[model samples]
Target: MLRRAPRECGSWWWDLDDVTETGLVPALGTAARMAAVLGKHALLEPSSLEWDWFERGRGGLGVHTRLGLMGSRLDDPELAEQARACRPVGHPAAEMSALLVTGPGERLDAEGEPRREPRLVELTVSPDPYGCWAEVAVHHDVWSPCDFGGEPHPAVHANNAPRLAAALRALDALLGVPGEPGEPTYFGVAEGHGLKAPELVDGLGPDLTDLL
Candidate 1:
């Protein structure tokens, strides 16, 4: 089994304010476009949608919902309706917040063999009326130059990093907007299309195995 970091190793963000219209339907449409790019590289195959609810003035109602996609795609018109239908009974004024698109993704094992992992790549999209945005985050070190133990994993990086970079590039092209690297985390930081190389001390990066 692949070891996952307690937090994201790296993440990328896209501001879709100009490219995508503000609304649930438009957000789902954007997700569909993104999923297409990611799926092409076998990064994320969206199978479910999850989100929290919040009222305008009352703030978060602490209610959450998850809808299975089954065989349906993100672009399916009914998906949005299904999501809205899951509204909490008491929170009539509640509205959906950022939607999380999660599913299985492929990663290469130590021997360079492909293995499937659930929620390998997490995608979140905000459908707020004011502005639209999306984020992609990875918790595993497959895209990193070194694993949590500070050990170099050239084979894993070579096998997986390129595919992630390609998907990010494709998403940028498809959305007509470039992706901005998200803030750095303890595990690693995003640099360009991949994780930044750690500053080695005696030819080894920081040992983060304890955190794992």
Candidate 2:
């Protein structure tokens, strides 16, 4: 079964039992590289990463943070240091946390120019030594105008949903696992699976009026 994300934006997630690479730092690097392949312009600086954690039990913990990146600098040394810094100390032997990163993605228009604004797409990873999971969130306003009900315009879905699918494909290639598409969020599923168009749903998700 697919897990529901806390937010109602365009979101997809994966719970991987065999994350070849472990540790928060390594996971961040992998996420950044994947973002780069998706044409993300830059990675959110490490210093800007806001992290929080709490103990769940003896040697168990939970972590959560929203990370941002920009300008395609995944290899920046300083950024790496910041990612390491974000790792909590005295953490449990096992933990689960969602790492979110957002930056500019490549989405061209009919004129072959960028159709979406900078930092419109978001990527997430829930990395753990034993296993991990990840998610992606996109604010519809970043693509186009929405109605009071929070449905993106048809043109917006046409342009952005496919981009989300392509990015998910790239991520799957990296993970070596075909991710199961989650329930349709505010936007839609990213798994193209040979379907025509971006295959958007009929109704709006939870009220995102203020978020838009």
Error of 2 at 83 (Å): 3.5
User: What C-alpha lDDT does candidate 1 achieve relative to the native structure?
Assistant: 0.90
Cα lDDT for residue 210, candidate 2: 49
Best-fitting candidate, scored by lDDT: 1
At residue 168, give the lDDT of candidate 2. Answer: 68
- The TM-score that candidate 1 achieves is 0.97
TM-score of each: 0.97, 0.59
Residue-level lDDT for 126 in candidate 2: 53
Of candidate 2, the 10-residue stretch with the lowest lDDT total is: 41-50
lDDT of 2 by residue, 96-145 (tens): 45565654444544344554344455666655666666655554433333
Q: What is the C-alpha lDDT of each candidate?
A: 0.90, 0.51
Q: Write down the worst ten-residue block by lDDT for model 1.
A: 105-114
